[model samples]
Target: NTTAAAVAMLRDIPVHMSYSIAVIDRQGNYATVYVNPDRPAEVVERRVSTNHQHGVEWAWHAETTKSVEREAAVEKLLLASASIKDVLSGFQRPPAYQIQYGHDCGTLYTAVYRPLDASVELVWPGSLWRQSCADFQDEVRTIRFNDGGSGGLAPTFKEGAVSS
Candidate 1:
């Protein structure tokens, strides 16, 4: 049931890569995907991957707390969006994104809240789904850099590099 919930969630989300959802448990655990025998059956908290751990445990907590705060702000904007003017007020503002869950497998739930300056919308559905989430920040950064530069960041790595 968890597997199905996970898969369903992944399927529901708008993403490019073909993926399967895997629910991670409380003890930093997630069931294995049988599709890849070589891959581990479990992914623990941060056994998954992250750019950097907080300098301290509390630091991480502080960040999580900040995220929850940001989440609340985003939700508030969505709830208060009664007019297009309200939506366009922050039209160019970046969105605050987050994913949260309770338990896994049975009635699993994963949500992606994208609250831009525009009208905020949320997709809270059963399943853990994300694609290129981490890279999105980098993508934004790239735009900023390129916009500031005369031209743009050149593509250093060629797609054909691996063909030979």
Candidate 2:
């Protein structure tokens, strides 16, 4: 049910280029929703019924070696979201942030959102779809980073920031 909402959000977003899109639930589980057939097939989704090895992994961690101008663009874009504002309000108190990477012409912002807990949550959303999501799973994998106190999505937090 939640996966369907994520997919709907992807389709509603307008993009200039073809790109694939995927979304991870609060539990770090991912499901591919958009796949650009124009691009080469990368992440192929499998009908796994209690099977753990059917889906392709996502590039949960990444960096553009060529310094794409998209990084700055993403930061600026995310600043517009309510989530960023909430984090910036108390970034130094606890839950230190380590920016990973982002994409788009100032459209996508990807990074970790940590609260009182040491664990972190990967939050990214862009204005453009880079390509169909056909190869996304193969190209990206859910990244697990050890930081903060416990891991969780902070903006939509609970129990005064986090819980074990």
Candidate 3:
């Protein structure tokens, strides 16, 4: 969600611009993304776990509850914060926004994008956070979630390609 929006800003494009984004889990196992409704002509190569085409469908499951809770928490934080940094900072727990579900699932990293400066801040699994700036056109930034350590770097990708 926020990451996708940040990516849109980084690319200097409208959020509804026709593009497909994929987000893989920490283990590089599972992945998900919200399909772009504005671009019905675009084809998604992967299966989308949660669909945002119509509206949020709350199925009976713990995973769904966690997802809904995180969405609500992020919305509340977004409204209260004065800046993107504030919003990112607020994500550090008491509310426990970071997920760590042993071997099954967990949050690998958190990121914040500052479109005005073309900069992004990445928070790794060990609570280590770093910031970097780049030319969104020629170079793209990415975060890799691994089983041990997680990190990010700005890599050269084909123009208009989305990384998650």
Candidate 4:
């Protein structure tokens, strides 16, 4: 019911471009809705989008290699009970994970949400943080980024002790 309500809410919003939204209820039931100006909203169990429309069949709409590879990786990740760490660790290379350069798109952060526990986990360069709706903690920390192409972990922060 919640997923249906969420989908209905998206239908009322004005869309300027193609995008997908995944909603999961507390019961672990989820719905992924794809919306585009070219066609009606569609529901899929899993989908990936990147500046390309999936609603309409356009000869010009090409799926980037990045998107294709990611889609396949995501499919494998989704098949198992993957944790936030599992998902984050899965994207270990270019396209899915990029370091910001002169003017290229770089992955800033990855977030995982748990509807049942009302919790969210986030991963940055070399840092991992998680918080629950019931026990939110705010702290100041620094993360360093390795702009150089060294095969070492960069943008790392000291693991601070977390209290519940």
Candidate 5:
């Protein structure tokens, strides 16, 4: 069912495009669909993608150096059973994290999802959002970014309950 849904979604996009999408459900069911322009979709369980065509030879497409680095780091983290916090930190690593104010495409936020609980935590430069299926409240938890222009520094996560 997951695979079918993923394929349907992929087909919805106009053809002749290289893309990847992660589809997940609260029951721990998930699928990542990869498609190269003019090619069929393939479902991959363990993969790292950053705006490039996957499931193909590296020489066939242009995968940025930073994307490669981040993918490798994620593979290592997945092997080590890293927590969501650690994964998010890895994403903030050099060349991967971006905060260009004037750029059209820069890192705006990072998200951590625990499908079993249907909980998601979204982290931005100055705030965080945490919610679960049980509690539908919408709130933004402000946090401090101590990077000082340096990348890869994890935001100073706050303790205690979220404030209103």
Candidate 6:
């Protein structure tokens, strides 16, 4: 997966490029990449997220007010963040900043990846867990609802950790 590859690359080399990469492992381990072409070897080492947003190779999706609001919220957090944890906090639920796809889709989990520690914290709609990079596997974790309320698309998982 691209996200896994990105995290692995970050661990092994200086990833400086023009694009964004988001990776999450089975244990909710994740890494988001923000690259700048001008500085092709420097990693910002921060947290970032994306949802249905367009990129260089993709066309912009139909933007709704909600999507714009979510993007704005993320950007605001990123700009005001003083630490990586602060940025990760933006993905937390309650106010429902995390996106849900509706009855057929729901917010399954939110993840935070710390490259410095090579650790990932996962937030399920009803639970939470953490995993280390060394223990991570390229497998998807599935959560089954007891109420037969099946909803949520599992995010992809990637392997490897960032080594400073």
TM-scores vs. true structure, each candidate: 0.25, 0.25, 0.44, 0.68, 0.63, 0.44
Error of 6 at 76 (Å): 0.3
Best by the lDDT measure: 4
The candidate, 4 or 6, that scores higher on lDDT is: 4
Clashing pairs in 1: 2-105, 32-41, 90-117
lDDT of each: 0.31, 0.35, 0.44, 0.61, 0.60, 0.51
Give the Cα RMSD of candidate 6.
10.2
lDDT for model 4: 0.61
Query: With candidate 2 superimposed using the best TM-score fit, by how many Å does residue 72's alpha carbon deviate from the native?
Result: 29
Residue 139 CA displacement from its true place in model 2, Å: 30
lDDT of candidate 1 over 9-109, digit per residue (tens): 54445544222233543233344222222332332222111111222235564364343444455556657887754643322132232222111111112
lDDT for each residue of candidate 5 in 1-164, tens digit (9 for 90 to 100)? 35466667776576576667777775557767887677677777745566554533563233434456556666776677657667676666544564433333345567777677778887664456788889978654544333335444433434345656
Q: Please, what's the RMSD in Å of model 1?
A: 15.9
Candidate 2 lDDT at 153 equals 29
Q: Model 6, residue 108: what's the lDDT?
A: 54
lDDT of 4 by residue, 98-151 (tens): 554323434556777788889987777556688888988875545444454545
lDDT of 3 by residue, 22-130 (tens): 5433233322334453533332334222213224544543353355555567667777878856776666542324333334345545665444555556564344434
The local lDDT score (0 to 100) that residue 70 gets in candidate 6 is 57
Higher-lDDT candidate among 2 and 5? 5
Write the number of the candidate with greater lDDT, choosing between 1 and 4: 4
